[model samples]
Target: MLVTFDYFLKNLDLSNKNCLDVITQGQWLNVHPAALVFAAALAQKVGKENVIIDNTAGKSGLYIDRMGLYDWSKTESPYHYSRHEEAGRFVPVKQILTSNDQSKFITDLIPLLHLPPEKSQVIYYIMGELIRNVLEHSMSKDGAFVAAQYRPKSNVLSFGVCDTGVGLKKSLSYYHFPKDDVEALKLALMPGISGTSMSQSGTGDNAGAGLYIVKNLSKMTRNYFVIYSGTAMYKLLKYDKRIERPKIHSDPLDDRHSLVDKLPDFHGTLVGVDIALDDTSDFNALMEDIKVSYSKALRERKERRYKKVKFI
Candidate 1:
C-alpha cells in the first residue's frame, strides 16, 4: 500500500558516504512518480556514480527502467524496449535547469500524452508553475527533475517534480519566519503569502499563487496534491465525489488533507499530483473559479489582521 511505502520512506538513511542502496522486496513493484523523481533528485545530489539500485527484484524492474530511473542513475537496465513503441504513454525522467528548458518541456509534454488541449491544459499550468518555482526559488544548480505517467485504464495522469536545494523553511526565512517545515508548507500554500515578499499581496514579479492554485485545482477535481520538503509533508486528500460542488479553501489546512512532520529530511522539495482526466473541467472556467477564491481568501486574511490590531 502507498501508506506503508510512505512509512518505509521515512526510514531511509541518506547519509551514506559511499552509496545509496535502493532495496525493494516482493515480486512486484508499484513505483510512484514521487518515489521515482525523489530517487533521481538524490542521485544528482550524491553524484550518480555513488548510487546503486541494489535489487529491482521482479517484472516491475522493466517498468522502472522504462520510466528512466536507470538512465538517471548508475544502473544499467537489463530489460529493453523499442523507443518507438512507447508513444503517448509516459515521459522519461527529464532534468530542467533553465527557463528555456522549462518552456521546452511544457511544449513537448502535450504530444507525449496525446491528450486534447482541454484535457492537457491543467498539466501545462501545473508543470509551468512547479518548474518555475524550482528555478526561481529552490537555489538548486541542478534545477527540477520531472517524470509522469498516463494510466489509460484509469484515465489518470500522475507526475512528480523534485529539486535538491534550500528547503521551504529556509527559503521562506528570507522574508518570513516559519518555525518548522510543516508551518513553512502552510504559508507556501496560503494565497498571496510569498517567501520573496512580506506584503499582503506579493511583489509585482510574483503573486505567490502558483501552489495555492495547483492545490485547489486538485481538490476541485477530487484528486490528490502532495508537497514534501525537509522533514514534513502535506497532502491534499481527494474530495468526496458525492459533493456536487466542492469548496476551495485559501487556507490549505481547512481542506481534507493529511500532514506529517519529523520524517527523514529531504534537502529540497518534492511535489506529486494525480489528475483524473475524466473529471477535468474547462481550463479557462477553472481558472476563473480559482481567481474568485484567491481574491476572497486574501480579503478575509486582511480583515482578520484589522480585527486583531490595537488602535493607539
Candidate 2:
C-alpha cells in the first residue's frame, strides 16, 4: 500500500519529547526507506514520530555509450503521460543521482535529515536497497526525484522519494494479469509479486516483502509510509501500538479503503516516509554530518590525487 506525503504526516502526535526534539528547528533533509526503518527503530525507542511529502515522478532510462552518460530527466516524456500531485516544501539538493557513486551520493545526503541512531540506520538500509536496485536493474545511470526534509520546531521528521522508472507497466506487461495502471499497481503491491516472469538467482524479493516490511514497520512504529507506483497508491497509516491494539496484517489500517480504489492507470513510482522526532536541535547536527562526511570524503580523494600527482 502507498500513501501521499501529507496524509502520512497528519497521523502523528507531535507533542512527545522525542518526537518534538527531532523536528525542533534548523533541520532539513531528503532520504530513502531502508534508512527509514533504522530511523523508526530509534524513534520507537525514543517514542518519536515523523512525516513525509513525496513527489517523485517516473523512471529515467540512463543509457551510456559513445555519447558518455545521458541525463534521463532531460529527455522527452513517455509515450503516454500521467502526473499526480501530492504536498510539501522543496529543499535544494541534487534531484537526480545516477552514477557509479549514487549509493555514496545517497550516503552523503542521509545525514542531512536529523534522525536518531535507529531511524538513521533504517533509512540507510532503505536507501541502500532502493539505490542498489536502481543501479542493478533500472538499467539507467541517472534518474530524478525530489523531497523536502521538514523538522518541525518539535524536531519531527518528514521526507519523500520520487522516481520515474519502468513502473508496474513494464515491470509486468508480459504477465497474464491486467496491465493498466490500477491493476498493475494492485498486483505489484501484492506480497511476492514480481513483474518479471523469468527469474534467476540472488535476493529473495519479488514477493512484496520490501513494501510489506516497510508498511508493517510504519504501523508498528507509528510513522507515515506511502508508496505510489503507476496509478495505485497504498498508504499505511500511522498506528499507535500503545493505544491501538497490535495489528499483524493489512486488513485493518485506517486507509484500507485506499487499497480498494481503482488503480490510477499511470506510470512510475514515488515513496515517502515521515516521522516525528523528539528534538529539533539535532537537525543541525545531522546536516553538519552530511557536510563533514562529504568534505572528509572529498579531502581523502584529494589526498589520493595529490599523492598520485607527486608520484607521476
Candidate 3:
C-alpha cells in the first residue's frame, strides 16, 4: 500500500481500508512533513480504531506516534512532545489554533528545537506569518494543523502547516488570477501576490510578503522550501552557493528548483520549510539583505510599469 493523497482519495471506503496497517507496514509512503498532517486528518475522520499500527521502527512510525495521529485521545499531558538531539522529533501536533495565541506556541517551540536566540527569532517570525496566512486566507472551517521536526545530525529543521479548504488556485483567483495550479503556486511566492485586494499597492494589513520572505530566508540559509497545493508542487533546494531570483515554472522537470505538476490535487495548501542550522551566519543581516533586495525589485518593476503607461 502507498500512503499518499491519491491513495486516500481513491479509497473512499474507509471501513474496508486498514489505514494504520498501511502507515506501519506499507510498501511505500510519502514521508513529507505534510503527509503526516494528512494522515492525522484521515484518522480523525475515519475513526482511529480502523487504523492500527503494529510497528514503530522507521521515521513514518515515529512520526505517526509523535503526532498522536493514531489515537489523539491518548496523547500525554502538556500536549507537546520533544526528544532532544534526536532526528525526526517534533513538538506535539497543533491540530487547531482557535485563538490568536501564536506567540505562546512559538515560545514553547524554540527550546524544543534547540535554536539559538537569533535563529529562534527567525523561526518565530516565519511561523507567525504562515499561521496568520492560514487564519486569514485558508477558509477551512477545521482551522490549521502544524508540526515541526528537527534533525540534529543533518542540521535541518522541517515544519509544515496544512488546511483542508479551497486550494491556492481558488484562493488567489480573487486577485492576480492564475491560469492553473502551477501558475497559482508561482504567483503565491511573488512579493506582492495575495488573495486579498487590501494587499494591493502595499497598503493593507498584508503586503504579500510572507511566502516571499520565507523563500528568501530558505535561499540565504541554503535550506529547502516547498509549497504543495492543488495539483502542483513548488520547491527550492539548498545549495552551496547563493541563488538570486530563483525560477518558478509550470513544470521544472527534475530541476533543483522544481515546479512539479499533476499531483494528487490537495484541497487545501501545505507550506513546508527546511532550514539548515548554521551558527556562523548572522540571521538579522540575512533578513536585512532580503528586505533590501525585495524593495529594489519592487521599485524597478514599478518604474517599468510607469514607463509603459500612455500618459496622454
Q: Model 3 segments beyond 4 Å from truth?
A: 1-32, 42-59, 72-89, 198-200, 241-256, 307-312
Using TM-score as the measure, the top candidate is 1
lDDT of 3 by residue, 134-246 (tens): 87788887667777777778777777777777888998897778999998887778777678863434445767778888877776676777787888877776555545434
With a 3 Å backbone cut-off (N, CA, C), the pairs that clash in candidate 1 are none
Query: Please, what are the lDDT tens digits per residue for candidate 1 over residues 120-231?
Result: 7889988999889999889999999998888889888888899999988899998889999999999999998887899968898887889999888777778888898999
lDDT tens readout by residue for model 2, 96-169: 45544556555655555534465555555455545444443333333544333545463444544445456655
The TM-score measured for candidate 3 stands at 0.77
Give the candidates in order of TM-score, highest first: 1, 3, 2
The Cα RMSD of model 2 versus the native structure comes to 20.4
Per-model TM-score, in order, reads 0.94, 0.50, 0.77
Q: What is the C-alpha RMSD of each candidate to the true structure, in Å?
A: 2.1, 20.4, 5.8
Poorest stretch of ten by lDDT in candidate 2: 61-70
